[model samples]
Target chain A: MTDKPRFKSARESGYLLCIDCEKLHPLSLEGELCDRCGARLHSRVPNSMNLSWASLIAAVILFLPANMLPIMTFKSFGQGEPSTILGGILHLLDQDMLLIGLVVLFASIVVPVLKIIAMTILLCTVQFRLQTNLRQKTLMFRIIEWIGRWSMLDIFVIGILVALVQLGNIAHIEGNDGATAFAVVVLLTMFSAIIFDTRLIWDNGVTDLPSDNSDEKDTP
Target chain B: MHGTPEQLIACHECDLLMTRVANKPNEDVICPRCHARIFYTSINSIERLLALSVAGLILFIPANIFPILSLQVFGQSQSEIILQSALSLFDGGLVLVALLILLFAIVVPLFQQVILFYISFTLHYRREGRLLRQAMHAYQHLRGWGMLEIFMLGVLISIIKLKDIADLHIGLGLYSLAALIVVTTLSSVFFNPHQIWHQIDLRRQKRATDDR
Candidate 1:
């Protein structure tokens, strides 16, 4: 690893790739629009960290009501019982639908909380420029981005149930306020992840550190 | 502009600039520093993309036209297609939520399929230039918005939730939706944007020489 030549980043080499057109342009055109497609050219996303932090904070605040309030209310013969996310999972478990229960548990509860935590860590690590575990951090960021969308599973379930189970006063299903909050939480976290630029994680890698003897010796 | 297309390959992840080396089909060119896949020579990619997109198009009709699932309680049954659900949500005063579902689950996926089909058709027929580039850009922009598979999983969970309260019956729409999800995913996997761009560049160069 020490003997290999260090790769120069586009930023270091004075070029920026247009995210829209994938065309490489000189860095002198940074604030100016892309000549090829007229899209804004930036070496990195502008205000990425600040925007990510704001969205993540909003998502964290919304997560409480999303899990606590009833997502769906079930009515049978004029008697109604509203089910929170945890209550719904426990109900499934009690009914011996272990597989479905676990799926809901993982998709609804575990995934969102884990996604929030992951985003917070990634944003903080990048903001503080912690050089340790940069590779692992990038991989974590990828995994979070990929799985963040799965949390929408619960919202979809609510939409379908609210539509299908409307039997008019006898055994009806109606979506409660929590469903909306849950949906917003999912969307906010996703936006936060997207707003974050994963390339920043590797900005302060070993190559950018103070010159060591190994690096000096490797340079011919 | 300064180098041949083969010499212009830059790793989007690590920004490592290197000349493109010849690789067999299905071989991936990975960035040495970041281990990100820079490009891959996908075998028979255009055909695979076209077939998958067509399959998704075929499945899209039944996925929307037929009832997704039917619920029966006390001998009274209610069924709805995906669109009706969104319409009902609109009626229920959840307009934003309704539109969100409609956009992500229905509209965006269909638009993505159409874009994929257009690009694959153009590529297979050896038509290149501005239209192909526009389609490629549209596909990239629309790629992140489609969530058909997530919607299907949500329907599955909904069915499970309804099982205890009523007689739940699966519909043709459900089956078509399952198939549609599979087809769309396969289409995205087989569609390589970099390869399509390379093809476009090659055609442009050829046309330039012919004109000269």
Candidate 2:
């Protein structure tokens, strides 16, 4: 954990590390191939911004229907009750299961929203080339990648309940449109995170500038 | 490492180029600019990874087959297995959601355990038959899709959600699934993907020299 000044980027030094295999290839080489693993090499992930932005935009559109529409319908004695994402959380809290309630609220609601917002901010930072708070933004991106999968919690819950709660007519659970939408939302966001190139954050509008950081001599 | 030229490593997060340092066991090299991990080391990596994957595979069947919980409602008790989670959803006509659940909760995790075991076993013995690179490549791709731990949490939350409505009893599958989650997470925490790549490269090098 030593903090030091930035140095020459591999992009500027004219080499690329294979994102798949970590094999380094000089950028000037024609037909760049990862000599170690043979994955086609790219200096930066090609079309990273476009791919991530496309995925993120789709996720943003899906997020609404995912939350608003009923995910599951619980029926007891022919009486049907449908619950949205927020509705389910409120139901859990109303049952006085404080810890479980908060966990659901966090997983089902908070995490997805946070992930969406964090990804947007990171994308904007890259698009606008905002160098301030780059480290924190990168850290946030890491956390986003790790936590993105957990947003599937709600879908899994619906799956389990839909499977388990079928007791003929007395009580049963049925999956709905929201579950599908939510599942797609989770997948899209995860893809956006995966498609995003973290290195793009550090380019910091300096891809064209020939001045590499000169503080390498004195800095630790 | 002995006869190779000095390697230059680039930070994946920030793209800063730095000369690679051979890491001691369990050492992690942190990127100076963005504090991302540049190097991750693991001791007995292949053996430990294989052990965990084998353990996960052993638990996989029972974890999916046995009832996660049995519910008692109006004196009629019924139990639900983990696979039913996906099967039931598909029956309900939420085909995509069902398939996603099937993929994330059951299929992908099982595939991961098998692929991991295959990759590690092949890498450990330096066995030749399968394409090691493609196998390792698939293993890396599978890592993102498997959500075993998240599924475990969903199990717990579902249990709590249904607790008030019915008398629910926890079952063998839940216990096994919990163990599976612990084993997989532990293996992931201290893994060295590069070590696997390096070993495969060594094997290639050895074969090349033998040809000469």
Give the worst 10-residue stretch by lDDT in candidate 1 chain B.
B1-10
The candidate scoring highest on TM-score is 2
lDDT of model 2 at position B14: 77
- Candidate 1: regions farther than 4 A off: A1-4, A32-38, A208-220, B1-8, B127-131, B206-212
Q: Would candidate 2 be rated incorrect, acceptable, medium or high by CAPRI criteria?
A: medium
Worst 10 residues of 2 chain B by lDDT: B1-10
Q: Report the Cα lDDT for residue A14, model 2.
A: 75
lDDT of 1 by residue, B1-212 (tens): 33224245556654555555676888887655556777788889999998999998889999999998998888899997888666766667667677888989899999988988888888788765366766777788777779988888888887876777679888999999999988988888998877777677677778889999
Q: Local error of candidate 2 at B180, Å?
A: 1.0
Please state the i-RMS of candidate 2: 4.3
What are the per-residue Cα lDDT tens digits for candidate 1 across A11-74? 6766666666556767777788864455688878899899999999999999999889888788
Clashing pairs in 2: none
